[model samples]
Target: MKLPDPPTEKSFPSPLHHPRTATMIGRWLGIAVVICFLTGLFSHFQQQTPSWLDIPTRPASLYRVTQGLHVLTGTVSVPLLLAKLWTVYPKLFAKLPWPPSRKALGTVLERLSILVLVAAMALELFIGFLNTLQWYPWPFPFKETHYALAWIIIGALLVHLAVKLPLITAHWRATPADRTPIATHPESLPPAITGLTRRGLFRTVVGAGTLVGIASIGQSVPAFGPIAVLAPRRPNVGPQGLPVNRTAKDAGVTAVDADWRFTVQGPQELSYSLEELRALPQSRSNLPIACVEGWSQGARWEGIRVRDLLELCGAPKGARLRVVSMEKGGFYATSELPPQFASDPLTLLALKLNGDDLDLDHGFPARIIAPNRPGVLQTKWVHRLEVLA
Candidate 1:
């Protein structure tokens, strides 16, 4: 049997490049980009400002998450941006009188602004991704470069939009969603399905899926991959050999039916209390708890890395990890580290702080101590570990 004929060029117009869709996407992306830029700037100021200015101590984990989101959105925007640019490319080369008339000058300025915006977007996304992967190629700090470029990009975008006001207005007037289909054939496409049509649905679905993939995989997946594979063993160094604060009665936080109880759970499984967790291989480290907040402290951390604990429990790889407090309402904070951190010697399910038994306020019983990361991501008072696949 023969397969159905492929869609004809005439039957399927180049695929609708809906002005409404483009505008909506661009507007939302523009807002997101602005937010990313502002947050980055604020984070920088928080670090640089003197104490007299009384800036709040920004948490290291907060910066990591915001920065992560910023980079993720920027990377995801790459394709959407390219598509928008292609859809508008025809206007770039449209015939114009060469004598520098007002219209010609205006068009020239708009195009130049677009060129700069595109270039800036490319540079920022590329550098941001590298930074996340722990690669810094340029002499300038990534934060500095990113901050400077952000202003330029935003300024150019504003100018470009202002100059294109007339065209944007015309497009809006021509294709209000209530009056017309949401998408139409690409100018390059054959004349079939002339007005906004079902093709728009396809683009929307594809674009939404792409956005989800970028957000989820870019931010969460890599960090949650199998811990054993990435961080096979604990790091030799820990919080600078800080003295343990615990009493002789609770060495290694092994005491049962006390202020602390270790909680370990595999993905989709019941959790174990502190005594149960002590049965696993034991490791200890003294490392620095560095914070992006401009404060650094050293402490000795003891316990198994969450990775080893999870592996012992037969937990699946790349699960969303959560740590809860043992207190009432289980008041807790969370940090999502890649599985690699789990196996790293520096990554500890710490039961002690400053060489003492776990402090109640400082995540007593058990907390996570991850090297080269902010304290907030450390998740203190760990009463539960929920593995989300």
Candidate 2:
């Protein structure tokens, strides 16, 4: 006996289900994906610091801008992704070829790619946004999984682009037919009745992306801080007027006693007491402590410049250094300072923040402050600087 045929889906007309619409929305979404991916790559490299990759130390604000853009672009893509999915919802119901032919197998693979792309991209944005809140409710390792999924999403996206390239090219630059009636039936709602033409739908999607961006971007953009209510953090709303990723107590760091000393190990191994450090000539730099969590705040920092200390210790002008922190049992307990960062005039062993002695949580006594470096690499509660080269 022959098996019965499967039931077919009833096709419904969605005014926004046109190829031109998907093309237009996809162009912007593609741009967002590229920005998010590249910025994410930069961030991963910053944390991993492969031997072959040479990260720059100039302008001191390069990392700040790239990371801020990374988060902002990722957040805004949420709306774009939703709109793109909505536009292509009809495709989910498109009939698959029967009898398991070669063409049918290819169709299955293409659909599989779309499934992977959507799932990975959606999860990526979700976890990334949650991470900025410092919340981890997932079972897997956040960093490793996030990194791996990024590659999977990109790969699936490439496959999807290859499948959709014909359609994208056909409608990418075509003029919208505003007067075209969507349906002839009297009861059927057309663009004129719904007041949602192709142009109107495109504008609506763009508006959604813009709104999400403006609402959340303030966490990274200082100008938008007051209105970044949608973001997980307020730049100046944390303890001592700046958000804390890790506390001294949590890092197992306790208050130092009178015997506590700060040292520079080089040709001349020099050590200084708290009072002696305070007596040394102090320099000031207005720098922002930008975190990977997507929050940042600008503060006035005063201390001996790293280059100055290197000079005092008889270290070479462009030597790299290993900055050691008092905090224990953390990946950031010590960080490497590249030659350019070590020599920057603005890079300081910050002893003061906002005109007051450093808060214990904020790396009191001394901390590294270099332009454009991540907060984690700033090496808070610093006790030693060893010239590496």
Candidate 3:
């Protein structure tokens, strides 16, 4: 015999209908997307302006990390976002027009805003992924398109958030509470519905895992080709054949020896001499350093990769790597390199920037050149490397 029809109207929803961990993740992901978009806009502008504009030049490493994290977060959020939209799809049909007695103008505007956000998010993430893999499918400059659409997306997001404020708050409040559970019904099925079961969980896990796996492999994958969608115009010639500072008297600075000492002591402590570092097997790489600040510079770097150095020092794994400036408290920064990058030969503790010796302003004796990373992670004037595991 068939079971009685599931309750259509109940005080509360079933576990499937109720907001679950995935929905919560989606809400946070939405918030994070907003923040990432804002920061990205700021970064885009900062990179576009010249050095004379007084905008702090973001280190190449910083650009890489922020943009990478932004992309990573977006990638991982995809499944959660889809699941959330699926669960809430029914709400779209509820006839709760704003100012119920008034015209449907507000409803139209709300619906339009939702459409923009959804479309913009999909386009941005998809285009962004393609750009990362160095593939430009469209003729238009991705940077220009991305910049123009960002404004639209942000505006749409604000309007959507404003419209949903009340419902969102109510949902959050009810989500955590225990009430009379309702039974599921066929009529409650959402469009493109997928059961919130093992299959759904497996899909999310696999999707997220694939993204992380690709990012990890990206460190050594060279032929990924030039997506160059957002890349500023490439320089025609190399280095302008600039002269190097040879003599201490001519350069007005004393050149330090390879025997020079380096220390890394903030939140942790460690030290390495130039010789000890050089004793490690040397690695050489020629990679383009792409700055989010809109300038791209290419150089041939030579030195021990940070990974080898870390291994040599027996630094504990999973520690946050902090590099201290050698130029008498000049500059310092921190980074968290994933295992793949940390171990990649291309990620060098560069003793030389370009073919010539390192300049004082350019991290004198040594700095780092992390592949596909923004300049910030490539800490300059690196005297000390601390691992705060």
Top TM-score: which candidate number?
2
- Candidate 3 is scored at a TM of 0.47
Q: What is the lDDT of residue 217 in candidate 2?
A: 83
Q: Which stretches of candidate 3 lie over 4 Å from their true place?
A: 1-26, 50-53, 57-60, 92-103, 173-389
Tens digit of lDDT per residue, candidate 3, span 180-209? 233355576652453344234435655664
lDDT of each: 0.56, 0.86, 0.56
Off by over 4 Å in 2: 1-10, 178-190
- Please report how far candidate 1 places residue 175 from its true position, in Å: 5.0
Q: What residue pairs are clashing in model 2? A: 60-371, 60-372
Q: Give one digit per residue, the lDDT tens place, for model 1 in 1-389.
A: 99986443234333344455456456656766776677666555544544454332234244445544554465556665665665555455455559888988877777778889889977886776566545788888776787788889889888878976766666553343424443343443433344544345436645763654444442222333223121111212233322222222232223336544455566445556666666667678765554332223445677777777677667777544666644343112444555555555567787765557665545556778765454445665566776655
Task: List the candidate numbers ranked by lDDT, top first.
Answer: 2, 3, 1
Best by lDDT: 2
Q: Which model, 1 or 2, shows the larger TM-score? A: 2
Candidate 2, number of clashes:
2
- lDDT (tens digit, per residue) of candidate 2 on 321-370: 99998888778899999888899899999999999999998998789998
Model 1 RMSD in Å is 16.8
